[model samples]
Target chain A: MPTKINIRIVTGVILLTVQVLMVIYARFDEARYFCWAPHDSQNEYAIFATVNDQTLTPDQIQKRYRIKQKGIDPRAIQHIKDIIERYETTYGKDSPAEVIMHYSTNGIEKPSWRWPKT
Target chain B: MSVNPLKIVNNEMEPQLLLTAKAVVLGLICGKYFFKLSDHFLPVWPIFDYLGPPHVFEAVLKVLFIFGCAGILFNCRVRLCCIILGLVFLITPLSSMVSYRNAKVFTGFLLFMIGLHKKGEVPWLVQAQVIILYLGAGINKLFEPDWQTGQYFEHWMHNIIKNPYYINATMLLPPMMLSKIMCWLTIAVEFIFPITLWRRFHVSFFLWTGVLFHGMALILSGDDFGVFSIAVLCSYFSFVKWPELIRVSFNGDNLLHRIAKGIVNVFGFDNHFVWQEQAGGPLVATINSQTHTGTLAFKKMVLYLPIFYLAVAVLISLAPTAALKSKCALLLYVLIFPLPEVIGYLKRKREKA
Candidate 1:
């Protein structure tokens, strides 16, 4: 017969283990977002991929991102901004900083056109 | 001296106890397939990319085919039905692998155990599968960095309370603390799941905690994970001493007690006659009660009656609109099925507390 004490102890340990695993999973593992991108974005679909990439419409981006959007870590947003700035500086192409700024402030907006052909 | 036919027939019911097991296993399998059909093919809302040319026509056809085959087997021999039920264990994991291996593996174990009910033996294969599942999930979670630091829980909670359904003013507390608490709580629950199953710790706390934790996840995220959590609680069935509750139930007020006891006894019951109680006597009694009688009867009825009646009701309700054929029926099935039980469970718990 299973004693209540035994159940309690087992429960405690298992609870701890799950909590720990969840934290580790959230931090280290790549977040799984169900969204659309230009097929090369490693299956990630941010609400605005680099803000002004005309090929990726805001509607498409928002649709993909909106499907599974959760709370974004404040620090994670900074990380995104840092990566974009670095990429723009390295490429030396007149960067879409203003577009990036627009998305960062306004969130994603819907586009008037249909989804890009998959 | 003449032997009473009733007495002889009563004697025969003992050997036929396994029939009950066959019925339950068959019932659950049919229930699941029926449920899937409604959810996948005839949903009220078009799932994701539904209107775009049926993306999973093959998968949909396979389910229909299996549902048809299972229906035939259910009407045939019990022993043969059970063997075929056992074979279903193979198909679940294979199909799951085509989707996501992790989900498949987890689902496979649940299916395997539920299938084991056909013979009334808690096979070693099932026990091992359960242990491996919990251990594997626990280990994987342990190694993840976000999980280790507790940020996952923190992130989850901050967004969780913001969902319109779960919004509460009390959630204005610091996210860091919530995150840490959630992180530890998940690990602690997973680590001890197997231990509690093995009798190293009491399982009720773990099971109840899991219900709360997972319940929170479901409510906040609108995820169906709460169903899986409830199924996991069934794993601790061996440890649940359900008889105490029934015994206590009968102890209050003489008039009520007699009425309850008389009803059970009149039905020619063993321990299995009482809901949620384990049989204390006879191999047949234990197996039969769990499978053929009492709570098992309720379970079987819950699975079969809902699908059968709802199918008829749907057909009638949708007769005017032949185009809606199964779609309208499916909506009614999903919406109405859990109402009584969900309300009952909550009411019972409230009364007890």
Candidate 2:
């Protein structure tokens, strides 16, 4: 009986600790997985990209990101930034793609992000 | 006679509640997986690049997820199925940052806990996980400047949702004040729920509040969170100590009663209700020595009947408009269903006076 009680207590503690830690981590991390803060931000964003001296259309931008080119992303604006950065640094590396994203977070418009860091 | 929330225990175990929870959670996951399979025929997501060039590991995981869901639903090695499903949810999010949703992770954690649960034991871990979820959500929102200042709600309602009701309200009341009120109400409720849910007396109140809160969210957002609200509501069954027997007596001669009986026979897998003919006034249901008549009795019947509850949830989720959904939910879940009981109580009080 004591062993069972201890096991239960340990399990409970481990489960709760992990959840609490994830919640804390969410504040620092851009990808808020395991965090309960859903819809905390309404990121209205537009993505622009130029690959090999050719400007990509909205359809191309959507295809690249697997998200709509211009729409409200109900997460942190950083999520969009990360996706753009990952794609540019990865499969599109050799192509010399220049990407820019202008976004507003919760009615407050922030500066645009340019790929390759200016 | 008042219905005691606790003390409704069977000698074996409350398999009904557990099974219902499993079905709802797994069913929602299955639906999500179906969409994922259709959307990405091959694992073109960045996370799949690590396993192999061909995406064989991702393919196997998807197949396993399907089998896991089927196993759980068919009652074949439920514990093993839960573990497999839990692992799939845990690993799937790692494939891409975009796929990571708080609801998915929470669902995975829940399945893991469910898998570990022993029969006839109080589900302390499952209950704790729920409390932690609400508490984390509340605390996070409390600290977020956008949430505290009502900016998030303002932007969400005006731009993202384009909710007509909110827009109409903005005409009469100050938009900031209205948004602030909504923001604080949500924060308070989320915080209060975690504290209250642990108590037997408070569980039912918080559960009802949670249903209304999440129901309103689904209406306004239109499945943006994707079964998060439904999963949370279904998880509330974990807290309830469901009655072993629900005796529903109705007139067998009546066509309506016969139809109701037929529905129960078809859907009530656990045989929670004991059907009998009492050719009299309204349909009466006796649960835990407490008798309910009229619409209240019908409400109780539906509450215990998991299939009916799930059907109602799906219908609410599928409603096209926020206005229509809110009106229907308020009428069925809140007003009309309980109005008869309130009137009865008032009449009895007047008679005694």
DockQ of each: 0.04, 0.55
Q: For residues A1-118, could you state the per-residue lDDT of candidate 2 as single tens digits?
A: 4544666457657867977998889878766656677777788889888888899999998777677778888776777777777777775677767888888889899898889897
- Candidate 1: residue B171 Cα off by (Å): 5.8
Which segments of candidate 1 are over 4 A away from where they belong? A1-118, B1-98, B101-105, B114-120, B160-175, B203-222, B238-253, B258-271, B274-353
Please give the lDDT score at residue B49 for candidate 2: 65
TM-score of each: 0.43, 0.83
Candidate 2 interface RMSD value: 3.0
lDDT per residue for candidate 2 within B1-353, as digits (tens), equals 11111112222235544554454544465345545532221132655666654357657777877777766655556666666777677666556655666666666777767666666778777788889888888988898888898888888888778888887897788758888888999999989998897666567667777877886776665552655665677778788767778888898777877777787677666667898888765688898788997667776776676566556555655665656666546654563244565588899999999
List model 1 lDDT by residue over B41-139, tens digit each: 222123422533444643554454364335323433333333344334333323221121122223334433333333333343334444545654565
The clash count for each model shown is 41, 0
Which prediction has the highest TM-score against the true structure?
2
Q: Predicted candidate 1: what Cα RMSD to the true structure?
A: 14.7
